[model samples]
Target: MSNLVEVKNLCVDYITFDGPIRAVTDVNFNIKKGEILGLAGESGCGKSTIAFSLMRLHRPPALISEGKIEFEGKNVLEMSDSELRKYRWQGASMVFQSAMNCLNPVKTIEYQFWDVFDAHDMVSNREESIKKAKELLRIVDIPEDRLFDYPHQFSGGMRQRVVIAMALALKPKLLIMDEPTTALDVVVQREILQKVYQLKEQFGFSILFITHDLSLMVEFCDRIGIMYSGQLVELAPAKEILQSPYHPYSDGLGNSFPTLIGDLQEMRGIPGTPLDLSKVPPGCRFAPRCHLAKETCHIKPPHIHQQNECRLVACHYPINTSDNRDQLPIKLTQVAEV
Candidate 1:
């Protein structure tokens, strides 16, 4: 399948008073037509940064220093603002983090919903706009009556449903969701995700789902990309990654999450903070905490190793099937068969 969106050699640098802080490195990935690719890692892993960069939403402090963001065979970075406006929602739309709070408190949900249509010149008649807004609310499983209510009047989950409805108003080909359901309770989150899953099937839209919850990503994503510091350390099919992670950082993340059906225990989060972008160390940024770090890891970051048809890992030691069984770390062994 051809890629719906292709990002190549992407890098983002944040200019501060002290110096430039690199938030994203030479990252390259693609979203195939109708594929849902999950970007999983901790908060500071630059998942959201990449999402923002794609929309050219980065502010003055942050800038896309190098890369090509291609959408439908065109370079997005070179597009003019007027040209970009045409693609912003009709071609691609983003459901942001804590998007519930992104709604305008003063405006009624219906007004907010219609504004999106008006911005895109999709609706001209006020009555027709209201009718469309009601339809969108129903699409997201929200009550039609809530359309007249202000954003502040609804609960967080309810407001989130409104935002999602707004995003779907255009039926964009690509939907970028950055923790779309993170603010809701588990039951609500599941319900919203199920709706999103249904929407994808119904609309035939591709998604770039970004989240730190590996378990959630595993359950929802077709493929998963593991990011450490600013780089994509691993990318693989969800099941393959869970069962046989090759990168040390990826292995550590897999081990941190408890099994959903077996144990039902609290997840042990990854230890230690990520490397400082301004003062990034030489070689691999994850070298300090990686258990498999070696002399080679100290000098340079390893090239991504394509182990099989689906798995890719950037590691000096891509753990083979048989490698010093006794010397292998406990966490690595446990997740190797997950």
Candidate 2:
């Protein structure tokens, strides 16, 4: 498939009296048309920062330092206010991390849906908008009778579904979902994601799914990009990463989650705390925590290279070496065969 969005050399910084604190640096990736591309990492790894940049939602403190955000061949950074106003909801939309935060507490659910129509001049007739609103609500499994109810009247899961309904209100070509199901129960989370995956197939829109759960992402997304200290350390097919990860950090992240079919084992999360943005170390950002790091890893930055036609990694000593290559792949293959 062709690319729907291309983000190249992206760097986002937060300005302070001292200097710009780089939150996300040198990130590059593309979301293919009708594909679900996921960004996975521990908290504060710049996944949200990159999402905000795509929407130009950064406030005064946060700024895009250097990058090109190209969406559908148009430069997002260069769009005028009017163009952006039209582009945002119609071309692309986002379901923010919190559903409660996304909805206005004082406004009725119908008004929340109508407000979007008002902003883009999508509809002037209230009855027609109401009809459309009911359809959207139904898609997310919300009752049409609840359309006039306030946000607080609904449960957390219902509110999240409402937000999902709003994000798809415009039939946007791309949808950015940032931690969309974090606040919900596991069953609700799975149900909502199933609804979204069904909607993706029905509407044919691409998705940028951001989350910390590598296991969940691997199941939901077409490809997974693992982030560390604001940098993209690895990108590969979801199953490939699960079967045999290339980066040490990616391997470590895979080990953090458990498998239902396997014998219970201790979850070995990546060792050490995340890097402090204010005082970032030189060379490879993940070198301090990576057990495979050699002398060169601490002295010079590892260059991002294509590990295969479909995989990319930024590591001096990737785990997929000749000596140990395909070890996990064979195990996973056997599991699948069983």
Candidate 3:
């Protein structure tokens, strides 16, 4: 598949009286056509910042200080307001965190859909807009008759489905879902994700699935990128990441989730808090918490390097290598108690 979106040397900073806080630093990754790429990281680790920056939705307090965001060959950072407005829902759409509550309380479901269609000039009249809305509702398994009901009338799950339907109304090439199912219950989350997977299969639109749920990402995404302290520490196929995580942070994150089938491994929380962005460590941000950290690790940051044909990691002492695979489990166990 061809690359659908490319984020190169992306950096986002928050302007504050104290100083600029670097939220994202030199982040680089790409999403392919018709593929789902998951961005997994803890809150405040810059996952959401990257998602918002991709569509130029980030505002003044947050600025794209340095980077290039390219969607299907056009530079997103350079687009005019008019071009961006046209590109937004038509070329890309975002299903934000807490998206269920994003529905306007005053508008009926049908009217909201009409607003989307009208904004993009997709339909000429209310009748046509309603027709499109009904079709979209049907796609998400929502009853078409509910279109006239107000936002308060639908259940939380139903409201979320409505948002997903609206996002797809424009048939965008890229869909950015930032914790799309975070607010839903487990059953609802599964149902919604299943529906999303089916829709992706049908529409062939690529997805950037952002969430802190590594296990869920492992199950749903084709490839996964693990972010830490505003940098992508690891990137690989989901199965590969699950089987042999290279970065210590990635390994710790995987262990944090329960596994039903594997040997019962202790859930290990990554030690220490996330880096303070305002005064980020000089070398490796994770070295302070890494069990394998050496003097070199604390003095020199490691650049992202190809681990093999299918994986990449940014760690001087990566785990699961032929030389160190034997000691990985022991080191992980020791780190778990920290």
Candidate 4:
């Protein structure tokens, strides 16, 4: 399938009082038409920053210093204000993290649904818009009668469903969901995602799914990309990433989530905080915490190697997995690759 969105060498930076802090560095990836691609990493990993750049929504202090975010080969960063209005909803729509919080408390759900159409200049008249709103609510499995209630009247899950329904009203080509289920309870999260998965299958929309939940991503995403220190360190099929992660950061993440049927185990976190972008070193950013650090790792960053179809990794010592036993900061750089 052809690429629906392509981000090449994308870098986002923030000018702090201290200096320029690089948040995303040399990021590159593409989402194909009708595919679900997951961006998996811990918090503060620039996953959200990439989403903002794609929509050209970064505020002051945060800037897309370089690189291109191309939506169907058109540069998003170069779009005009009017162009952006058309770009946002018609081309790519986002279901943001805690999106329900952005809902207007006083506005009835029905009124808010019309606003989305109004912003895009879609519906022709009030009656037509309300009819459309009712249809959308039904599509999201929300009751049409609940449309007259205020946002505050709905539960978190219902509010989230409303937001997602609004995003789908325009039938956007690419849907960017940043931790879409973060606030919902586990069962609700599953229900909402199951609905989303079903909708994607029916409507044929590509999705950029971002979350720290690796296991969920594995189940939902056809392909997965692992981000580390603002860079995409690995991109592979979901099963490949889970079974044979390459980058040390990706490997560490795999270790953090245990299987459901396995012995009940305590979940562990990756040791060492991500690098401070302002003071980022010249060499591999993960070397400080990597167990397989070598003279080469400290001297320069590694290039991505395409080991197989849809499997690419940036790591100097990806094959070594010997140090898995090291506690807390488990360094698997020495462990033999299975």
Q: Flag regions of model 3 displaced more than 4 Å.
A: 330-338
Worst 10 residues of 3 by lDDT: 329-338
lDDT of each residue in 42-140, candidate 1, tens digit only: 779899999998888899899999999999999999999988998889888899988656788788887887788888899888888999999988998
Model 3 earns a TM-score of 0.96
Q: What would the per-residue lDDT of candidate 2 be over residues 246-324, giving only the tens digit for each residue?
A: 8888888877767767666666767799999898878899999977778999889987789889999998878766765
* CA RMSD, predictions in order: 2.6, 2.2, 3.4, 4.0
TM-score of each: 0.93, 0.95, 0.96, 0.92
Please give, for residues 191-233, the per-residue lDDT of candidate 4 as tens digits: 9999999999999999999999887888788999998878888
TM-score: model 4 vs. ground truth: 0.92
lDDT of all predictions: 0.82, 0.88, 0.88, 0.84
Q: Give the per-residue lDDT of model 3 (tens digit) for 1-338.
A: 78999999999999999989889999989999999999998888999999999889988899999989999899999999999998899899999888646899988998889888888899999999999999999999998999999998988888888899999999999989999988779899889999999999999999999999988887889999999989999999987777788998888887787766635566678888888888777789999998888998989999988989989899998889997686466333221210
Please count the clashing residue pairs in each candidate, in the order shown: 0, 0, 0, 4
* Order of the predicted models by TM-score, top scorer first: 3, 2, 1, 4
In candidate 4, which residue pairs clash? Answer: 321-335, 322-334, 322-335, 323-335
Q: Give the winner by TM-score: 2 or 3.
A: 3
